[model samples]
Target: MAHFDSNFIMSRILLTDEPTQIGCVYLEAGGIIGFHQALSAQLLLVVHGPASVRCDSESEVCVSVGDAVFWEKGEWHETKTETGLMAIVIESEALNPTKYMPVKLIKD
Candidate 1:
């Protein structure tokens, strides 16, 4: 087990406004979240295992633990896993991940 020097660590606040929803999602093997438009800005953070994600007509991209995928409101997207996975999904009109995380550029 790892240990921290301090007994307590201060946490920085990110969002102040109430978000539409924040929830955990579990995708079973061979499961798929069908293609659909995002009603609000959405962020999906993979917490366990691996999965594939696609936005609009782009090619599907593989994502594993610690990967974060963001989709803007009204954008078409889909997610699926062949071996099951768990993720945290955050949806909000005020969501802005760029402010806190660096962008991951994908080479064509």
Candidate 2:
């Protein structure tokens, strides 16, 4: 068995604009976010420590506190941690949520 700190919790709140959702996340050393897609153009800023980010067709880059990065809609990317990382992120609900429809799942 393996013990993982699993720093995956994120705090998100809809902005006054209502169409924008802002959030923050903290990742301890060794944390990783596997490849994923962004439904809306997303912006992220490193609040503290260092963050490693890689976008589709691009080499990974290390961004320090105060650095900002953007990913276009539908872009594939991934983030990993070499050290602790803290970041703020924003995504537009108008673009992503408007098309979201939950599918029903039958379970026992």
Q: List the residue pairs that clash in candidate 1.
A: none
lDDT of 2 at 83: 87
* Predictions in order: lDDT: 0.86, 0.71
Q: Write the per-residue lDDT of candidate 1 for residues 1-108, one digit (tens) a residue.
A: 236655765322148475579889998999999999999999898999899999888998999998889899999999999999999898999888778777886534
Colliding pairs, model 2: none
Tell me the tens digit of each residue's lDDT in model 2 across 12-108.
Answer: 3233454776789888999887789997877676888987888876778877886666677898988888888888887874433223323222222
- C-alpha-based local distance difference test score of model 2: 0.71
